[model samples]
Target chain A: MTADFDAIVVGSGMSGGWAAKELAERGLKTLVIERGRHIEHGTDYTDFKAPWELPNLDAVPEREQVHYGGRVIAASTAHFRIKEDDHPYSVAEGKPFRWFRGYHLGGRSLMWARQSYRMSEMDFEANKKDGHGNDWPIRYADLAPWYDHVERFAGISGQAEGLPQLPDGQFQPPMELNCVEEIFRDRLHETFPTRRLTIGRCAHLTAPTAEQQALGRGPCQSRSLCSRGCSYGAYFSSLSATLPAARKTGNLTIVTDEIGHSVVYDVATGKASGVRVVDAITREHRVYTGRIIFLCASAIGSAHIMLNSRSERFPTGIANSSDMLGRNLMDHVSGLGAGGYMPGYTDQYYKGRRPNGFYIPRFRNVTEDADFVRGYGFQGGASRGDWRRGGGQAGIGAALKQDLRKPGGWSVWLAGFGEMLPNPDNRVTLHPTKVDKWGIPLLHIDCAYGKNDLKMARQANRDAVEMLQAAGFQGVNERKAEPDEPGRAIHEMGTVGMGRDPGTSVLNGFNQAHDVPNLFVTDGACMASTACQNPSLTYMAISARAAHYAAEFLKEGKI
Target chain B: MSISRYSGFSRRQLLSGGARIAGGIAVGGGLAACADSAGQEASDGLAARLDTLTTRDALRRPGHFFSIAQFRLLERISDLIMPETDTPGALAAGVPQLIDRMMVTWALPETRSDWLAGLAAIDARARREHGVAFARLEPDTQFDVLSRHDGEALSASDRAYRQMKSTIVEAYYCSEPGATEELRYDPVPGPYRGCVPFDEIGRTWAT
Candidate 1:
């Protein structure tokens, strides 16, 4: 029972927004389904409020605090609450995956770490170059145009210094580094020939272009409290950027809370008829029919749907001939780094909010000092110690209060994001007995890395500590991060990867399932390899490219 | 899952008011008894809910239950941390509420014991050292007390208590209100002027 619409896109997060915008802009009738509730773009940003304005005095319950705090004095901004009682996924006993996710219409885009970076030729060619899991079906040249397309509309604030491994994008004026960071950058570069540090290329609007102003977005307020959702439309989230553009095209129909349960596969035609979804709130099951389907419900989420789509022709799962539907999961192994007091900057401070920090982009086993097959990058910063700097001391009374008024010493902190090589052993499967609230089988994730991930993590941490000590910061030390587990970084990717060889992989160059031409998976599930950089930007570009291609293909009757 | 919708607040508010202060509301009459019975009642309308408090807050009930005068003392303490300078300060940012909620969780049994012990011992130390209770001591004496032996290694519980107090105070003032008001918070400052002269903007950034 094929429906009338030209295409259907599931999930409205990073990729979904791109799909919707691209399809609708091309005048295709597109139905966008979001598992979470709808969010009115400009209207709902709680971060813009004062502390007194929030309920519970901005306090998370004591019981809830210990579980959520990231151990850096509780900076796990409150949105990490995905009700454990309502939606439960099964894990092996003693294995805890702290999936810091918010299931909203915009998904993680609502709470994205908006450090936008394009995965260069080195990243795409890495798999084939090293004889790894699978070669990416597409390359940097194929995606460069789309990256430019997305970045231009998204308004990435950065300075382009045309390096091959780290390609430049359409960028706005970059945010400046503080005095301490500037000095650190110069010193580090002078000390080491290969090492280079630059201001983190972020999504916050430094200077909103005329294109942005036309979208009703104003310049960034620089309050730097962007994690709570940007009220100024300053950062690029689907709610703030893409969806709004899609809505203007007059061909986009959005249906929220319609969680895509499984795709309806037509064995005869080798095409997806539509999808079966259940109301995330009402528990009412419904079916949506469209000529083509684009699954963008995140990495693990899309895998769950694909694995659940059982048909007579494909019992293992829809398009699961390769038996690689839920394998090779990868998230950036993160939180291993160190920092210390920079004694000299006691008298200085900066003004306004610099939402981002210095990003020490991938300087790992790349060329000369080759330790591993893959690489990693560092996104960190230096700042003057604020009032909370008096921690680990006993102070009270008027005297204590008075001393607190003075700013403390300056300090530098560097946190690294290391690459986790894709391995078939690191996989997610369906838990037999457990079922979530919506009767969906719970995802049993059994993922772990090999020597490659470990070597990278250890090196990344040591380098940070050595760098700090070398920079003359006292008490320079390495943070022994909690053990690695899936969903920790929430940047889950590569469950059903894209590859040139359809004989070994599921999706193709255009993110279309090889077995089913009309079925497209444009989410993190389509990633062939998880590059060290944040994957959301790549997902957006790829989704837009695929959606635009799919619409054109449909118009040309290619499928 | 979608029952909750985010209330619209601005970056301006976030920069001006510190986040993460605990608050409890005796809504729907169920918690009315808990409210009145749990807290300490002073002559002033303000109340210090010690029974439920979990840690040693730097800014003690000076008061939190509902004593208007004691609450005023808290307001004054907050203001002192965040002086009017060019912008407003802690008092303008609702830091009293932030402290109140922090105290609720921070005043755990292990931590509270240290607080009661510390206060009693401090006064005793004052009496033994100089023959006067700490509260009655001169402002100079109090400053000396706070500064003395600040570098000493504290017991585990004592360290936790110290951490709580510093966190409460630091969090309150360092927040949007503490930084933006007491100093300055320009959320929508169109272009970032990297090396602006001090005289141009005047106040320093709190963060």
Candidate 2:
């Protein structure tokens, strides 16, 4: 018996959106399933709720904070960090990973940092160049066309500087850096030849093209609150952009609150027969059959789905011939940098809100020689504290009230993203005894920092402090940098990685599973190497590439 | 005829319960307006004043958890924490309401009771220094009485007071008037003008 839909994509995040759009646009009856509730663009955001307007004024109770401190990684921290009551995850003690996240149709892509930069040939060629975990199946050249496709649609706003490291993409007008940032950028250019500082190329609408405007998107109103999910549809999100495009195809079917338990694989045909889903609310069971399946349920999420899918065909997990189902887990080592008060720029101020900041692309380990294996990039900005800061000062009464009417002092901070090499030891496994409210086994993650990661973390802090001090910023404090725990950066990657060799890797260059031809893993799980910059752009690129190839393969009857 | 005379109930309640129940009354009487446009000074000031009057007794009458003396002392201390300015003060943010909410939600029975006892002892110190109860003192006397308790870092009452002060300030600043007017709240920024001279624009943009 044939399936109802031509293909079924298990998530609606960055990868799932890409899969759905590509499949439907190619005239495939695609069903994009999301386990979370549907969130509409510009309306579902809690950011519109003012401070006093918050249910409990956004305060994380002391007891709750201590209890759920570890789970507040990239899980649901876009608005306020997720309270224990919201999206709760499990982790073994002595080995805790704060899986900060939220469950919605668009997923974390709605509240991503919006830093859009392409990973260069160096990044793709790194594992091959230095005998790392495994060679990336596809090179930069192979993935370049897909990147172009994603950018042309996503509408990245940035200046097209001919830098080998940060490739220029389809562009709109870039947001201007403030007076201090201009001075710093100008000064930094003169000081360092190889190091380039540019305005953050973000997935925000500097000016909406007809393509974006047709999607009911408007120009960037310059609200700095993109993290709370932009209500204006001025930013790129599955909710705001891609899903709508898929809906227009009239061939998309979406099912929310149905958690993908496993893909029913037939060993004789060596193909996925259908899939089972557990209802998030009622715990009811349902089966969905499709011609092909795409796993887009985040990095660890997709892996958990894969590991949980145990059939007699493959006991370890589906497509786990190499035993690489839940290994090589990676997330950027964040929380390493410096924040300081700028001495001057008191007279300088800007109008409107720029949701983006200045990006200092990878310098240390990229161009120049480094002690560590990989690289790190600095996402820094020059900004003065706003009126909201008036509450923190010791001042009260009229003087306090008057100052509140005005602005606060000038300040700048550099938060660096450092890349960590994948290790099998740092892995997430299913809990043997414990299960969640949904009866799914708890994800017991055991990840710790390596020597190389610790070194890179220190260097991230060191370079930031040194540069700020060089700019004559007094009272510049270097926050002690350490990769304290896993999942802090929220740039979760690896598990089902891309590799050239079949024995060493699960998926090939096309992100199609070696064990199962029709199955594709194109989310953060497919990342071969974790780069220093934000991973959304890379995810978009890989996803776009996989979806197109999968469509072609479907036509060819490659499975 | 007295309605429900056997049950000793009022006639108005009987009539209201019988019929004539009304629908479609204007909702959001004031809070909605405050949330919408905080820039409107008069409406915001009135809302804040109403907030204070409604919850003002939170500091007075003995808290469900606090002793009578302790409750009275806390009321005196909270007012001094945010003395009135040109605009409404911390108490105007309905901080006492926040305190009572916290007591029910976060605090335990014994810890709240111990703090209440400590508050009474602290008030005893204030009373020994002055003639009347702590809440009855003038603004100057209130400050003098509170200053001694401010930095008693070792004392649990002092810790509780600091937490109370922080919550009050946070509530005030984040209030419609405090955040929007005083702090100049801007959720979404307009346009990003990179590297403009101060003369170009006279004011700062809220992040």
Candidate 3:
């Protein structure tokens, strides 16, 4: 029997959106399932709200504070964030994993911190060199073209520093670095020759091409209210870019409010047939059949679905022949950094609130070797304290008001994001008894930073302090705040990772399941190693590449 | 920045006003509600003028968390904390009303009582120092009494006092007249200028 559709892409987020766009563009009829309410771009965004127009100073009300678990969510974008009480998950008693999520039509794409970076050849070889996780089946050479393809369509704004560890991509005009950043960059080069500071490579349009402009995307306004959602279509989100492009292809059918429960295995055919979905609101189950299935439902989400896809042939889960379906969970080691106060430059101020920050690319384990296996990169900027700083200091009347008129002393902060080794112990499994309201098994996540990860974090903290102090910054204090939890970086990846051998991994070089030929896991789940760079750009490239091969495979009748 | 942008709130909403604090219903043109209610011209400071209007609103509007006397004391405190400078201060910016609205809808029960106790403490200090309530004291005397209280409370690191002061400062700055007039706020800054002289912008950004 013919399939209901040529292809089905699960989870309309960063990777799924790209898969949908590529599949639909290749003339394959694609169905995109989103597990949240449909959001109309621009209409749904609260970017137009002025300071005076914001309710209760954009603070989440005290009554509803219980839902957020002490995290201060801005009231303007509170709708994007799911209530923790409603969407339940289990973590190990000692270990804590902060699954910061947005379950809307565009998923976390709508609220992602748009920092985009590409993993280098060195990153692809790290696992193999150190014998951490399985070696990536494919390398930087295989993904370079796909990176160019996605970057052209998605519009990454960055400066090319010609560094090998951090490869440069097709980019628009890079956002300018402020005076202090420029000074710091020059000073750092003088002090530490290997270290380099450049503007953050973000998935935001600095110069919109005719293709992007035609799809209603424009240049960024630099308003710095991205968390609230950008109405201008300046920042690339699935809703703003891919879904629209997919729709324009006339081969895309998207259904919101349908959660992907599991992959339906056809035991007779020995290939995956379709996906089983649960209606989020109605709690009704339905099967959507297609010739091919692409699982782009994030790292943990895709793992959850794969772990639950139980069948007679694969009782552990569908495509779990290797028993490596839900293991080697990884997230970037975060919450280790330093900040300092800059004494001078009170006269220098920036006009717009630049959404992007300065990026100090990874120097350790590249130009200089570290005691640990891998290294980290620092992301931060310098700016004067605004009126909010007045609240903490000793001040009162007209004099306080007068002092607040001009911005206060310039202070800089450097937040380190260290690479995490793929440990088999840090994994996600289905809860034995506990299930969510939808009767779907809850994900019991047990993830923590390994010894090397902790060592790298401490070294990163020292590097930040040294850099700041070297740049003549005073009051150089290291950050020691609590809740330095894993997964707090929101760069979770691995589980169902790609490898050369079928016994060791779930997916192959093409991001296609080794056991199930017609099934593809192209999201963060396909990552063999967690490179220090933000994983979204690599995920986009991988998704697009996988979709390309999947389309070719269908045309060639390989499956 | 204009009051004309504040059309979401009706005349009744301007009086029965706690909904806008937490409901997030202010779509467009809803900033005028606060300015619309500030018509009573009185001598002394902006507090004395706001006292007449807020007392009436608090008495009639059931949404108001603070009582008439408590509301009046809050108005006096906020006004003194941020008096009418070159730009509109706390009273004209409706900081007291916003705080009262927050107490009803946004504050926890403990937080609300803590604010009430703080306001009562200020009044008691005024009565102990002088011979009248905080609101009844002369403008100069009110400033003296509040300044001493502010210094002591801030030095002691009083949570309630700090919360109230910060809220007032934030509210005033976020107000239309305060934000656009007192500080710079470009909603759609076309391009980023990395470095410019402070005099070029003249004021801090009130984002």
Best by lDDT: 3
The deviation in Å at residue A121 for candidate 2 is 0.7
Please give the distance, in angstroms, between residue B203's alpha carbon in candidate 2 and its true position after superposition: 7.1
Tens-place lDDT digits, model 2, residues B1-207: 111101211334322323111111111122222222222233224323332222232322211322233334555555565545554554545444455444434444433444444455455665677855566778777666666655452244355444555665566665554554444456655677766665565444423
RMSD after CA superposition, every candidate: 7.4, 8.6, 5.6
lDDT of each: 0.70, 0.71, 0.85
Error of 3 at A74 (Å): 1.2
Among these predictions, the greatest TM-score belongs to 3
Model 3 segments beyond 4 Å from truth? Answer: A481-483, B1-61
Best by DockQ: 3
Off by over 4 Å in 1: A1-4, A55-57, A63-80, A93-96, A394-406, A481-484, B1-98, B101-160, B171-190, B193-204
Worst 10 residues of 3 chain B by lDDT: B35-44
Candidate 3 residue lDDT tens string, A432-536:
999999999999999888889888988888889999999888999889633279888998999889999999999999999999999999988899998999899
Q: Is the docking of candidate 2 incorrect, acceptable, medium or high quality?
A: acceptable
lDDT of 2 at A35: 81
Q: Give fnat for candidate 2.
A: 0.49
